[model samples]
Target: MDNKEYIASGILELYVAGSLSEKENEEVSALIQENPELLAEVISIEKAIVQLTAAAKKDATYSFNDIKNQLKDTETKVITFPKPNRKQYIGWAAAFILGSTLLLSVLQNNSLKEQLSAEKQQLEEQINKSSNSLADAEKLIEVFRDKDIISIPLAGQTVSPTSYAKVYWDKKTNSIYLDAKGLPEPPEGKVYQVWSLTLDPLTPTSLGVLDTFTADVNKIFTISNANQSEAFGITLEPAGGSLSPNLEQLYTLGAVAS
Candidate 1:
């Protein structure tokens, strides 16, 4: 609204350039009618531009009419540029379509590859689980094999007659699978120790103590027995079992028939 602010806004320069928007042109026209001083200032600036442009145009020597005549022949000469024929344009269109289709196909192939990888991993996990189940079943089958296995039935002693155990002695492997299905778990801090007894001298050799006695689901233990013995017995002495069978704590006794 102020005279100094209006001149500094550069809107007047655009008005002189004939570049002001239609709404701006009408507003400036209204302002010129109201402000005589602003109107006089615009006339003086326009006159100076007219004089400067005329002088510059005179020095150029090329008249606008001569330039017009030169432009008149421009269309007559018809300077042709090399452009693709219709076939070439069609070929380019086909190539662009093919390229886009190929790119889409590659992305779809990659997605399918990822899906196949996930399926392969799933199949591998399933196979591993199946293999484990098969191995466990095979182990159960081997435990009951009649050949090369001496089954020693351990009858419960006077202390507990209901508690029975079967020792499947594998002489070839020097190992025995003691199935203590009928035996009750010993009290806390106590374990059952096994012994190999020779009938003649009554000499005894200590085998390993049963581990995980309470938590064993099948209550079957595979123990090493490289001894030439006649009888087997189990005794509950302490948590780690005893060096010698606690005669007082003997639970079960069984003899191997000759």
Candidate 2:
């Protein structure tokens, strides 16, 4: 169970108030030991209640002392019966103090709950991102391990000397996985277009264009290529791919090794 959710449930408040069942109290106690923040919250709640109770007692004592002083000033002899008005005043004063303290506790609990909720949301987001990254890594690993997959290393061309990419082709599936991690992001209104080349007459077949190059984190793309490809080349083209290979803008090229 999520510790943040448990804390936000307001069970900790009830635990401090001694309103939870014995079993529930034990569970809360165990949780507190595991989470220092939760334990701190419980301690704060308890401390606030204790301080309020102490302040109320001190105020009541002071009021009683003031009453005794006033009575002695008015008359030298002691009263025969206890003063009812004094008792009524003390009762009302204690009730008011208790109500205020209860109100403060409620507000504090709500504030803490809101903070816990925000923290929980942030934690969940981080977990989701981590899970997605792990899934992507696993998929890449599987692609690399396939025996039938032809691994082609495309070297950088004159346009981008440092740019490089790898193509993992599964001939049975007629699909290629392009790992473009080494390629630089295309400029605005431009994208990378991949081609399956037949070197005989140097004819190029459009495999597909990478529209999500900038957005893709791993820069891995899947493209279908049923052609008996002799070589693979990538070029920087307009948003939509050109009909023919733009040899001048070629970024990377590699031939299938016999």
Candidate 3:
């Protein structure tokens, strides 16, 4: 099945929930590695599950500590009875009530503890995401500051008048860091493909496809480009990309400076 059909099959949700069999899990894992869009979908499903779990935990109505304190503050009254049988019956009733209260208190406390633990886990995850984002920003700043990096600005083309993107090419490393933050998300079953162009012959070579555009938080992707490219262009194509550039779908283009 195609990536779009596979993603819409609801199997990713089951995979995230750990309901799939081991063999199925392995198959999904292999597919995720081969397809960026599938991996993105899986990650999205997992994040949704985490958010729902956190919300349910937050909605817990009772506080275990508060209930415990209230029980402790309650005053107990004792009365002397003229009949021994009546006194004995009252004592038994009191014991039964006390037992039920303690049992309930224990159960509630356990539930509260579980909720508290879940909240803590969610907090940790948020902190980690923040830290990772900060690290990425710092790394990008360093790349931009490098003296050897070539910055190329790709302007919008006829197909997309408002879309724009930038390329940071590191010739020393034979790689390019594409900043596509200004481009719109590709429609389902479509992806943006990058091309390395040699203007002398006007030949185009495929660099790679951005299949994870919808899932990428920063819209920046790293692709290997060892070609002696004189220009760069981005075109929207069907998922998995096209063998050759489709000029009709060209969204952005920029030429390298001498």
Candidate 4:
């Protein structure tokens, strides 16, 4: 029989209880010797039984040594007499009580194991979340420390007096990291659009719409801009970005440093 199947058959409980026949006992001992897991299972079962037995009898202490001694002893024989004494009846009653207690202990042990396993899984999930958060913080720190990056602060405009944002432009990569944490969440059916402006002709180029406005945790967006941008502006537009920014709906604007 498969070792797992044998272990799960409740045979280990009987072996620990010293209820198995001599031949069956030898077979289990050989299996336990070969498989460390099986040996561990047997030891756990034995310990639970001993604890249950000891708890059942307040005055008695049941140790592994006592259990081993009992296992080595020959099977008990029932001898018939003309009259059975009260001692024999009391002994039989005690055996039934101990058996019931052992069953309950086994059930409680299984429940505790299940609870421990669930807690272990929850701990692992928390560890993974913490690791991801740390990685994101490290990456953001690197972006701030880069030598080729320039910070441009965008102040609130007439449309939204409290709104503000920042743009970190990386000259070497021609990429801009838009930090819009201070901006209010967009309204229904409306999105925030970013623009790269040229002051000479007052031209505006649509960088892109902030599609994941509400879901983005960092509120930081990356957009490629190779233009000779003199200023940057943000406006509230329709679902998809507008061809040209609406001057009336412009929320924030900042001019590039000369």
Candidate 5:
């Protein structure tokens, strides 16, 4: 047979897989030595098998020389038969190896698809989170630029001389955005409380408590306030917040412009 016809017959694949009889193996080995093309084809088949085995068994190691040695070391059993068709035996062996290799390829492809799907989902979630944060920041910038919105700077008090905060009061919406980025995290079992103050009688109304201070990424909070606030104050209080402000624990205070 010509080189192309012999290679296409699939006997070389069975030879590389160590499925041929002793006499057949000797004949193939002699042919391989005489023809470089046949030797190259055998090496190519061995390499493909090594790659597939290595991918399926990630922790295992394989080498071309190992497969070559296994081919030489294979022992063929001589079974007594009235009339054994050597061609039929070799063809069946080649078909079985090809089917197994195809099955392995399919399984590996499925595993890769599942892994890619999970990674794509995680990437999409991260993108959505970043987009929402950007939208909120844009809205805040617009509010700060409004003509009716009040901007109040609360300076540090005696309790925390280096701390400061800012209040952006949207009176039309009765909402205030508090930027408490300058303040330190409160101690355990304690929280920061915001108060709207009236200076005439010095009456203080609790706006809300910063219960999520440590967990807030930007140190910014939104609170609803409908009181006629003449001033703003922040003080450290117990976990659930107090009905009244603690003057001694005041961290920052500011007066609203008339």
Candidate 6:
């Protein structure tokens, strides 16, 4: 018969429980020694009965003595029973569960740590933005504190109706801070130059080139004007600026009122 039919006969469970005769046990052992599949099926059934017997007892251990003592037969087996690995199996199972729990906890902690790191980075960025805003306000306050600064507002000219400029000229210190935020950029290879003008002869003195006009974040240019200037005008000149002003390229003009 097949291993299934042999196992379904219920003889293997009886043999494992020591309920079979001596002759039947020898016959079953001989068949298991020849057929590996039959031996496997018999061992599976035997394991179930062994587990049930082990649970019925209060003690946590079962050695070969226990198996032989359960047989209670004079001619049951020619060989001794194998030692039970009850303690070792229970220890390994407990260790496996503990290791699995520890690994899961570590993975969960790493996920939380990554989330915290992202939140901390976002908070740092927010703090930096607020600090930069405060620094800008403080810088503006310092810029407006000069006592010798003469404020001059230049309106839009015919060339650029939207252009405007504010000049903070410290005549006593010979320094002028020009705010050209409202002005449009000059064409390629051209730059704006500041002219300190005299009203009587309409003569112009070159202060300096308004370099980095577009690059300045505040759009405020600080220049030195040592001349006795009555008016100021902005003209687009070549890259390095000219020795004098070009009226044709004049963008805006305003007189320094007394």
Best by TM-score: 5
The better-scoring model by TM-score among 3 and 5 is 5
lDDT of 5 by residue, 21-63 (tens): 9999999999999999999999999999988876877676667
Q: Can you list the residue pairs that collide in candidate 1?
A: none
Question: Once model 2 is optimally superposed onto the true structure by TM-score, how far is the C-alpha of residue 225 displaced, in angstroms?
Answer: 2.2
Q: For residues 1-258, write the lDDT of model 4, one tens digit per residue.
A: 887888889999999888999999999899899999999999999888888876777676657986784575477645343443667876776776687769878998998999899999999999999999899889777888898788899999998999999999988899999999999999999999999999988999999999898999999888898988999999999999899999999999999998
Query: After superposition on all CA atoms, what RMSD does each candidate show versus the true structure?
Result: 29.3, 24.1, 20.9, 22.1, 19.1, 26.6
Query: Per-residue CA lDDT of candidate 1, range 20-126, in tens?
Result: 99999999989978987778878877888788778776455666887774675444434233465766686776777688779979998998999999999999999
lDDT of 2 by residue, 24-94 (tens): 99988998998899999899989998887787664333457667735644555432433447667778667
Assess the local accuracy of residue 46 in candidate 4 as a C-alpha lDDT between 0 and 100: 86
TM-score, each model? 0.50, 0.61, 0.64, 0.59, 0.65, 0.50
How well is each residue in 1-258 modelled by candidate 3, as lDDT tens digits? 998888889999999999999999999999999999999999998999999887877555776887774575456545433454666787877777788779978998998999899999999999999999999999999999999999999999999999999999999999999999999989999999999999977999999999989999889999999999999999999999999999999999999998
* Candidate 4: C-alpha lDDT: 0.90
Q: Model 4: how far is 245 from its true place, Å?
A: 1.5
Stretches of model 1 off by over 4 angstroms after superposition: 1-134
lDDT of each: 0.83, 0.90, 0.92, 0.90, 0.93, 0.83
Stretches > 4 Å off in candidate 6:
1-129, 141-147
Error of 4 at 231 (Å): 1.7
**Clash number by candidate, in order:** 0, 0, 0, 0, 0, 0
Please list the residue runs of candidate 4 whose C-alpha ends up more than 4 Å from where it truly belongs after superposition. Answer: 1-97
Model 1 alpha-carbon miss at residue 166, Å: 0.2
